[model samples]
Every structure is written in structure tokens, then in C-alpha cells.
Target chain A: MTEIKFWRGFFSILLVISLLFFIFHVWAVILPFAFGIIIAYLVNPLVDNLAAMGLKRSRVVLILYLILLGAGIMLAMTLIPSLIKEANAAVKELPAYTTAIDDLITKANGEIQKFIKPIFKSKSDVIAIPFAAQKFIDSLIPQLPQKILGVAHAGLWIIIIPFVSFFALSHGKSWIDIIFDSTPSEYVENLLGFMAELNATLGGYVRGLIIESLCVGLLTIAGLWAMGIKGAVLLGVITGLVNFVPFMAPLLGGGLALLTAYFQFKSFSVLVGIALLFIGVRLFDDFVLIPFVVGSSVHLHPVIMVFAILAGVEVAGFIGLVFAIPVAVVIKVFLSVALRHRKERLMFRHEHVYS
Target chain B: MNLSFYRLIKKLFNDENHGEEMSFLRGVPIFFGLSSHQLGRIMQAIQKRKYYAGEILFQEGQIGKAVFIIKTGRVELVKNVPEGGEPRLLGNLGPGQIFGEMALLEHRPRTASARVVEDGEIFLLYTATLEALLKNHPAIGVKLMRNIAVMLSALLRRTNQELENQKKS
Candidate 1:
């Protein structure tokens, strides 16, 4: 019996290792599939409502697809061109930005040298820190193709996402039922309770965050444009997309905006204005948007949330960073449910023994 | 041209399999006073599951998140066992009858255990899904809440009469 148990544990570990290996290798495919799942999850409630109105699931899916297609076309026609134009402009302005940044660094170094020269007896004794800006550029130049390839891969998956999501939304009920059906009868009720809790919390949180990100992105674009900031559109998109990452995203966005504003106008007031805009946006997000839109779904500690995000970045780069918080919530909820079940079982056993 | 357009629209919205599910939902009492359209909406939130005889659906004191409706099954609603005694069978539920209903109304533990007496299918109306539906369609939420109130009142009246009879005896 001990040997049997040992083998069971060993095989379980083996199985887990193999699964992780599979996930690691197929992350490229997995990312698109994960996106599809997210889309399906977000759209499912709407689909269910439509289906409840006597519309066939297939027909409802088709209608959703058509609506999505129309929206995509509209975006392609209107937003895409402007976004592309801005992106190209940003790319063209990159060299000048880098040069300015280099010059700024050099000026700061000279000032530091002047300040420290008095402390040192000889000029050679003072450490002359040289900025390796060229090395940074050279490294980035080689990685440029890989980054473009990644973007192209993402673009391809964007086309496939709708199809995957359509099927997921249409058959979501049956799929959930199928999964629950396979569980042992004794644990089914407990599992269902867990799933319902997960659905309510995680699903609502994700949908809310996506909407929040879009709102932040749009607000950034409009604010920057009104201020006549260069690459406003591109900066806005970056800000909005990054806004999903919580504290890190806003800081990154604000820092980029400040740097750009400093480079372009080179005025302290403009930089301060840009900073104030982000501060206002953050205030609005915290007070109004998060309350109305996101609610208090993600009950994570700030320290834990930051740690998970850093770990995620280490593991899977950008995608990891994006999904870290939601994944942590899922794990936390699942463990809590399991612990509750174990406690209940132990209590039951104790009661039976007393009886 | 009109006929083609009508056909296209029909093909767009109609599902043949929805008929059985729709009819089943219409019969559930909590779902009473709801229109066919409303019933169809409730149907979306319901999940159907099959259980064999002697399988426990839920245990007494276990937290319930969904109300179960018997679609094609017999379920024994049992009270908790006394020390060194068998579980007291409260009643059996057949097709169209519902149990674990307070699960839909509130987040609370089950007062009685539900165990399958025969191999059959049951539909579950999860509270979260129902909450989502209510949020989206306030009218349906109002109707369902009213149904639950009425059902509870009737149950209380019956229990009161039973208690009064016992007192007289």
C-alpha cells in the first residue's frame, strides 16, 4: 500500500511537470486561446440574456459576430489610420528623442562632475560615469525584428479570437455542465459553489478592468491632444493599455508622457500640466470609475499584487504581467474553497464520532 | 422578397432545441407569472445535470448557491440524522418540483439534505447567474422575487396550520 501511494504521488508530480512543460512550449498558441476565453467570458452574460429571449444560441452567436465585425470595420476605417499615422510619426521622432535624452544625461553628468570635483584632489580620482547609449540602441536594433514578429503573431490571433470566443459563448452552458458532470457526485455541489463564486468575482473584475482601461486610454488621448502634445494618440494608447496593470501602468504612462512633454515643449509648465492631468485621471479613476465600474472585486493586498506581477513578468514576460492578478485571485479562491471543504469534512467526522 | 427576408430573420433567431428547455422552465413555480420570453431568459441561467440513485445532491448544513429543479428525477429531502439514528426523510420531490430554493433567494447553508432516489436529471438555477439576469432585466428580477415571497408565505401558512393541529391533539 505504501509503494502504491508513493507511485501515485510520483506520477502526479510527473503529470504536473509534463503539463507545465506543455504550457511553456505552447504559450504562443495558449495566449490566443486565453484571449478567446477572456472575450467569451466577458460576452457570455449578454449572449445568455439574448438566448433567454428565445433567440437560438447559434443565431445569437451569429448576431454577436456580425456586430463585432461591424465594430471592427468601423475601428479599422476610422481609428486604425490615425493610430498608424501617429505610430509612424513616433517612430520617426525616436532618434531625436534618444539624442535629446543623451544630451540631458550628459548635461546632468557634467553638473555632477562640477559638484564632485571639489571633493576629490585630482580629476582622475573622480569616477567619470560614461552613458552607453549606443550599446542600448545596438541591442534594441537586433531585437526589433523579434518584436515586430511578435506583433504580427498577435495580429493573426486577433482574427482567430472571435471565432474561438463565438463557440465558447454559444456552448458555455453545456461546457460548464460537461465539466461539472465529470466530477464525482459527492463533490459536485461543493465544486459548483466554488465555480459560482469564482464566476461572480473574477468574471466581474475582468470585465470591469477592461472597461476601465478603455476609459483611461481615451481620457489620456483627449487630454494630451487638447494640450497639443506630440504623439498624443500613441501615448494615449500606451497609457490606456498599461492602465490595466494598476499602479505600475499609470506610473509608466505618466513617466513616458512627462519625458515626451519635456522633449517637445521643454517647458516646466507643460510638464507640470501633463503631470497634473495624470493625477486628475488617477483621482477620477479611484473615486468615480473604480467605484462605479470595477467595484471591490479584487481584494488583493498591494504587496502581494506587486509581488505576483513581478513574478509573472519573470515567468512569461508581458502576458504574465497582464494575467498575474487574476490568476492569483483564482488560486486564492480555489484554496479557500478547498480548505472550507476539508474543515466541513473534519467537523462531520467529529460529530459522527461523538454520536 | 418579403418572404426571403422573413426567412432570413427566422433563421437568424430561431432554435429548434430550445422548445423542450423552454417548456420545462415554464412549469417551474418560481418561474410562474413570467412570459415565455422571460422563461427563455431563465433557461439560459439553468444547468441540467444527471444523477444516479443513492447519490447525494447536497448535504445538510452545506452552503447552497443554486436552487435545484427536478426535470426527470426523484429526490429525497432529508433532515439531519439524530445521534446513532438514520436521517429523517422529510419528503420526496418529483418532476417540476423544486428544492434547495433559499439558495436562489440568499447565500445560506442548506437546511436539509437532498439525495437522489432515482437516476434522473435536475436543473440548477445558480444565484450568481440569476443575479446577473436580474441586473440586466429588472422586470424579471421583480417577478421572480415576488414569486419567492408568495411561495414562502404559503409554506409558512401550511406549517402554522400543522402546528395548530398538533397543539389541539
Candidate 2:
């Protein structure tokens, strides 16, 4: 029995390691399936509502799938082309943007030299500072096109996501049922309960994140457009996408917008306006958007949140950072449930002894 | 494989069990008020499990999150005593009988452990699933909650009478 138990423990640990390895290696290949799961979970309440209204579950799934499919097609037809056009335009205008930035740097350097000329004896020393700065800035410019192309490649995954989601919505329950059926009866109830809790945690967080990102992106576009900033739509998309990363993402997004504004207008007033606009958005995010969409559901300590995000980044880079909070919430749920269950057991034992 | 092969595989795995599940769900009283269509919707969410005789389903003090209804065979609800005493049998439940009913509404610790007396098949309905159902269709939610309330009250009344008898004696 001891030998058998030892083997069981060893195998289970091995299984867990293998599973993690598999997930890490095939993360991109699993995107459709992951997105499918999210789609099914997000749409489940709506399906249940319709089912309660006397609609057949399968029929409702089919109808929802059709509606989503239609929307996706419509988006692809209209939005994709415009987005592509914008991307192309942005690419073609890259040199002009760099030239503008170079002009601003030279102009700023002259102003700096004039202010400091009285202190500096040699004119060459005054020219040296700006020349080194310009060289460093120029090095970064060549990498911009590669980064843009990388984003364009990532956009291709969106096409496969919805197709898989439709099938998932229609038949995800059966897949769950099949899993439950195969599991041991002793663990079945606990597993189901855990899955339900996990669903509640992740469903709310994922859906909320998507909505928050969309709101932030749209608000950013509107803000930037009002301030007459170039690349408002592109910057808005970047802001929305990066909003998934807590604390650091907004800072980076705002910095980019400010830099773009300064380059285009070459004025301190424009940069200040951009910064104030972001501050306003941040205030709205903290006060209004987050509370309404995400809620105060995951009460994780700030210290833990920071560590988890850093650990996530170490493991999986940007994707890891995006999933860090949700994963932490899952871990918190499991730990609390286990601790509570243990406490109940101890209390029962204590009472039994007294009785 | 061809379409027929895929169909055969699917039929063997998924479709064959739904008829059995649907029929069993139709017989449960908590689900009586719901139409066949509504019952069918509920049936999709039902998780079925089979246990051998002497298998433990759940332990006392376990946090209950779902109600279980027996499909076949017997289950005994047992409450443990302190050290040096045998477990006290609370009740023996048979086909169509439900246990852990309060779990559908509240997150409470189980008062008794459930163990199979005979090999059994059971259906579990989770509270989260019910909550979703309630949010979507309040009427159905109300009907189910009312049935649970009625059942609890009857159990309470019986327990009160038993306590009175024990006190008098």
C-alpha cells in the first residue's frame, strides 16, 4: 500500500508538470479554444435567460452563434479594411514622423545651447550633447516598422477565434458533462463545485476586462481627437490593449501619447494637454469605470498583486502579465475554500469531543 | 474517418445518455412544475455520478454547494460521534429522494455524511446553476425555492415533535 501510494503521488506530480509544459509550448495553438471557452462562459447567462423564457437550449445556442457570426462578418467586411488602410497609412508616414521628431530635437537642442552658451566656452561642447542624444533616438526609430508588422501578424488570430467560439457555445456543456462522467464519484461533487467557483471568478474578470479596455480605448480616441493629436485611433487601440496590464500599462500608454503630441506640435502646451487628458481618463477609470465593470471582487493585497504580475511576466511575458490578476484570484479562491473546509472539520471535531 | 464514423462516435458518447437523463429528471418533484422543455434545459446542467456500495459521497462538515437526488439504489446519511462510538445513521434515502437540499440556497456545512448503502446513481444540481436559472427565469426559481421551503418546514416540524417526545420521556 505504501509503495502504491508513493507511485500515485509521484505520477500526479509528474502529470501536473507535464500539463504545465504542454500549456506553455502550445499557448498560441490553444488560442481558439481558450477564446471559445471565454465566449461560451460570457454568453451562458444570456442563453440561460432565453432558455428560461421557453427557448430550447440548442436552438438558443444556434441563434446566438448566428448573431455573433453575422456581427463578426460585418466587422470583418467594414472595420478590417479601414484598420488595414490606417495601418498602411501609418507605415507610409513613419519616415515623416521620425523627421518631425528629429526637427523637434534639433529645435530643442538650439534653445538649450542658447541658454547655456554663457557658461560654455567652446561651441563644440554645446553641439556634442544634442548629437549624442540624436544618435540614440535615431537607433530606436528603425525598430518601429518591425514592431508594427508584429502587431499586424497578431491581428490574424482574431479570425479563428469566433469560429471556434460558436461551436464551443453550442456544445461546451456536453464537453463538461463528458468530463464529469469520467471522474470518480468521490471527487465529482467537489470538482463541480470548484469549477463553478472558478467560472464565477474568471467569467466576471474576463468580461469586465474586455469592457473596461473598450471604454478606455474609445475614451482615449475621443480625448486625443479633441486635442487634435495625430494617430488617435492607433493610439486608442494601443491604450485599450495595454490597459490589461495593471499599474504600468497606463503610464506607458500615456507617455506614448504625450511623446506623439510633442513631436507633432513641438509645443509644451500640447504635451501638457495630453498629460491632463490622460489624468482625467485615469480618474474616470478609478472612480467610475472599474467599479461598474470589474467591481471590488478580487480583494488582493497590493503587495501580492505586484509579485504575481512580476512572476507572471517572468514565466510568459505579456500574456502572462495580462492573465496575472485572474490567475491570482483563482489561487485565492482555492486557498480560502481549502482553509475554510479545514477549519470546519476542526470545529466539528472539537464539538464532537465536547458532546 | 468519414461523417458516419464521426456520427457513430458522437452517438455512442453523447446522445445515448441524454434520453436516460431526461427521463430521470422528469420524475423528480422539485422539478415537477417545470414543463418538459424547461426540464430538458435543466437536464443539460445535471451532473450524473455512480458509486459502489460502501462508497462515501461526501463527509459531514463538508461545505455543501449542491443538492443530490438519487436515481437508483440506497444511500445512508450518517452522523459521526466522538471517539469510541459508532456513526449514527440518520436516514436511508431511496430513488427520487433528495439530500443536501439546503445546499441549493445556502453555503452551510453538511450535518451528516452520505455513504452508499447499495450501488447507486445520483444527479447533482449546483447552486450556481440554480442562481443563474433564477436570474433568468424568476418564476421557475420561485417554484423550486418554494418546494425546498415546504420540504424543510416539514422536516423541522417532525424534528420538533421528536425533540418534545425525548424531553417528556
Per-candidate Cα RMSD to the true structure, in Å, reads 3.4, 6.3
lDDT of 2 by residue, A1-355 (tens): 9999999999999999999999989976775578667777788767755554444467677777789879979967865675677678766766777676677777877787777778775763545334443466579889889878867856775666766766776677668878977887677877898776666555666677788888998899899989988777778878887787675546877988887787678899988888888888888888888898877476789888899889988876777787777678768877876676567556655333112
TM-score top scorer: 1
Clashing pairs in 1: A52-B40, A52-B41
Tell me the spans in candidate 1 whose CA falls farther than 4 Å from its real position.
Answer: A1-17, A121-132, A340-355, B1-4, B17-20, B35-38, B79-87, B105-111, B131-145, B163-169
Per-prediction DockQ: 0.45, 0.22
lDDT of 1 by residue, A1-355 (tens): 9999999999999999999999989977887888887899898878877776777887788878899899989988977888899789877888887788787878887888788888874763356656655567867898999999998987899788887888888787779888988888767766776676667657777788888888988899899999999778778888887776777556988998998899888899999899999998898899988999988556778898899899889878977887788778777777776786577656554332111
Candidate 2 lDDT, tens digit per residue, B1-169? 6999987755543444446666776677787677765776676566777778988888876778899999999999988876748988889999998898888876767778899999878888888766755655688787788878788898899999999999999
**Can you tell me which runs of candidate 2 are displaced by over 4 Å?**
A1-6, A54-56, A106-160, A226-228, A247-250, A262-273, A300-321, A331-355, B1-46, B50-54, B71-73, B80-88, B104-109, B117-121, B127-149, B164-169
**Candidate 1 chain B lDDT trough over 10 residues, lowest sum:** B80-89
Q: Each model's TM-score?
A: 0.88, 0.77
RMSD of 2: 6.3
What C-alpha lDDT, on a 0 to 100 scale, does residue B137 get in candidate 2? 64
